[model samples]
Target: MPDAKPRLIVIDTDPGIDDAIGILLALASPAFSIAGMTTVAGNIGIETTTRNGGRLLAFAGREDIPVVQGGAAPLSRPGPEPLNLHGENGIGGVALPEPVRPPESLPAAAWLAEFLLDQPAGAVDIFALGPLTNIARLFIDNPDAARRIGRIIAMGGVVHEVGNVGPRSEFNLWADPEAAAVVVSSGLPLVLVPLDVTRRVRASREFAQALRVAGKPLASMVADLVESYFETKTHQESRPLHDPCVMLFALAPELFRLEDLHLVVNTGSTEEAGALTVDGNGTPVQVAIGVDGPAVLDLLARTLTAA
Candidate 1:
């Protein structure tokens, strides 16, 4: 019998193809119980992200989870125009059936505040896979509620690799640097799964074949999504499964080598927005600098196949 209680968590995401994988991975794992999902504007608009969340929960056969819509834009300035990398609907041209349910009526930030405040202090964790707009809003609207979270594991930035958006920006951080700054300064425990480690991992063709052969509806959907995403966006046959790394790391941190960094996000200066500056006195966030790629991919394969 399992001895430990499942960690209660909320996923804040934009539902990129990778985001779908991440959600499924977390759902399949035994260590977590997803309290809810909050959708924000990043890879796509809030409406589409909210729809994707509902569809994803339906796919995972966990429709009891509520999907809530959050901020449609950034904290201060506008985010970049939606990119074609995730397709028009943010799923790389693969379509899932329309969700049976709709998003919750309460706004994402408000719902999150209520949910977090209701939980015991340090009882809930958050996996943020999009722009930090919703997170910043939590701090702004209910700063006390933010303290209830155990930790935040965010997927953003590029320390060693060249930025995918600007010379210094990853898409998520670039989408809302001001929001990132707010979250960093909110005095919460943050773990960043940045591009430096995520880039080191890729989804192999074997795993794609395995997903296709699994024959389950969700597996088939994931296979199609992965195929389309890699073919359309990547130069290599394999694509970086960025978001799933965060899920894997949460389940087993021993698979990763982390470094504690006192960091600050550059929220001003268009040229420098989203840039991460390391300083001895900046807010502390643990950054994954190395990961066991094979182990993570193996875990992903097992989770998707089992789900």
Candidate 2:
């Protein structure tokens, strides 16, 4: 019999270093057919994130896949990232040649709606590696298309862990609590890979070594990025690989354990506006709680360096 068709997927990304690594994993894997890459502003500016998408496609020989530009800012409450958060140009100041091909002309939300309508409802899985601005826009502009999404597996929120931004918020959700509120309440199939789980997938020295020994330009660059990530931590041996965990869970859901929880996303005007909390009356969603760390690390190494 002929092989089954690859899963259709759309990756909404910010191209942060971890986001770049997740993109790399998606490009290398054959189990999924990447329909398109949608860029959003999170780790840095929108322009840089869009460019990083082109650069990554060039590195992975997947330029045929469309890179469409998305939201420049969040749905509301626009603010600056922590100073020098992801370096000057995002991706930690890594050097990559400008991509010859330009991003698709249509804006991300419109492009996504058009693409979804062409496919059967519930056939496309969305890997959300950044804020939900673009996804929220899709809902706002095209509610019909939003219903077609199979699932939105997003990397955001923090259950018990301290917020990466302020006392009660993670960066992605904090960047746009309004967007997060929209998606969570849309009643779609949503899986949240919050920081409580992501902090466990650290880039060990051994994992970085595997990338360096792969003898490939893309892998080598990723290796350097991983090492540089630890430079500022000084006290820690490894940094939590954030967005990549989203892709890892996508590929190997059996390796993770999830819980059904109700979440309340604060969208008010106070400092806690972007905060995510648990309450019985909040939106019900699946939140990842456990993962097989070694197995995920192995998958990352093998897929990235695979022949």
TM-score against native, each model: 0.96, 0.95
The best candidate in terms of lDDT? 2
Candidate 1 structure lDDT: 0.86
TM-score of 2: 0.95
Clashes of each: 0, 0
The TM-score obtained by model 1 is: 0.96
Q: Write the per-residue lDDT of candidate 2 for residues 119-205, one digit (tens) a residue.
A: 999999999999899999999999999999999999999888788877788889888889999998888899999888888888976
Error of 2 at 8 (Å): 0.9
In model 1, the runs with Cα more than 4 Å from the true position are 1-3, 233-235
The worst-scoring run of ten residues by lDDT in candidate 2 lies at: 77-86
lDDT of 1 by residue, 1-307 (tens): 8568888999999998889888877887778999999999988887888898888888777888889999999988976788788888888877676787788899989999999888899999999999999999998889999888899999998777788887878888989999999998788889999999888778766678888898866667777877877665556668888888888899889999999888989987676788888888888889999998988787777776876
lDDT of 2: 0.87
